[model samples]
Target: MAGVRQNTSIPIPAIIRYDETDKNIIGHEFSLLEKAPGKSIDQIYHTLSVEVRTKMVHQMTDYLIELHAHPWDGYVGGLTPTNGEVTPGPPIDENFGQLPDLEKYWAGSESLESLNPIPSQGFAGFVAFTVGCLDHYIYLCILLAWFHLLRPLPSPECKGRRHERP
Candidate 1:
């Protein structure tokens, strides 16, 4: 947020205080920001005239253009606060937290470094990593399909009999 505020003309609430560690009184990381002025776009969008909406859209596009024009380190990851500086960090996968049981399927789920391919390896390396991940998922899908297809089904007429795939 600080980096974005520093680099772009976008309006953002100023951070009053923030804690990234669980040592705080709340026992969870949190940030307090100044209340931004103005009604949310969703709240007043319907009430806005077409001309107003078009002007708002143009303003938003200008902000986006400013953001895109801002310089960034060439890396495929999210910005994380490291030693009081915002730096490129491993991309967070929200699914890992949402589905705890699926964590086992992903190797090195506990280690962020292991999850992210080194940025120094360049675009080719990233492409290879992506292809490898796709291949792994495709293999899992095929294995699951085969498991369902090969499983024995109970016979309708006989209570103790099972029907096998011929």
Candidate 2:
């Protein structure tokens, strides 16, 4: 959330010690990043020309290959969030299915419930429900692909990113 009064300034991290009180004058919490330098990769990608981007992501691919080749523990010891790292939780509950999909992580209740049309109620109710579920999943995939390809995607703020293309 830091901003500059002028554009020419480069941002640099500051080191803080246990005895130092940074928030006293700077008015914010500070952490000393030992070796990490933070920059928005998304914004960096947005600034490149098409040709430059192809070459850049090619280099990125090599970097990723190097990363993937690095020796992992080669075992799933199931480390956890308590260690400040992500780990899968237990098998999700039935209601977890009712929760939003990845595409709708920040979606509003009204937006989600809008996906719920009344299922047909009759002897064919089971068939109708199955077909409805399939159709909903397919529709979601199509919507997600379209959003990723043609735009930055709809957050909770831009759920209206649903512009149909021919």
Candidate 3:
């Protein structure tokens, strides 16, 4: 939200109140935002004039430039509220997905607990996370190769040769 607010070229909904603690709510913590004026781009995109569309693209490009210009704190994750201080943690998606969507790291109650950010050890944390995901992908590829070996695919018929199914 702060990132969007910092970029005036990007029009985002104003945050009214943000509650990270869910003690008052039934489910996950929530944030209340002021309703952004005007219809969503999805709704009016088809109706927009070519000039308006061009202007929108220019505005979006400006927003992206401004957004990317900000310096990061050398952390990989989301901002965690610890001892009333905002600290960086391992980046986790709000929907419980890992940064690169490798797999679920927790289950049941543990999933809820994982909402708290994992403390990233600078660049090492990101490196480890990436390495682990790559390893998992390689394992999956090996399994696929083994499956293909066990159940070989049928050969395609060529112009001169007649191929038989195994």
Q: Highest lDDT among the candidates is held by which one?
A: 1
For each candidate, the alpha-carbon lDDT, in order, equals: 0.60, 0.41, 0.55
88-139: candidate 1 lDDT, tens digit per residue: 6544444332223234444444443333333323223346547645654564
TM value for model 1: 0.55
lDDT of 2 by residue, 53-160 (tens): 899779778755754454333321111132533442221212212333412443553343334322322123345545656665675566557455755544787576
Model 2 C-alpha RMSD vs. true structure (Å) is 16.1
| TM-score, prediction 3 | 0.52
What's model 1's overall lDDT? 0.60
Candidate 3 or 2, higher TM-score: 3
Could you tell me which residue pairs clash in candidate 1?
A: none
Candidate 3 per-residue C-alpha lDDT over 8-120 given as tens digits, one digit per residue, 9 for 90 to 100: 45677776877655445554467789998778899889999999999999988887787656555444445555574555544454644432222334434344324433334
Model 2's alpha-carbon lDDT is 0.41
Name the best candidate (by TM-score): 1
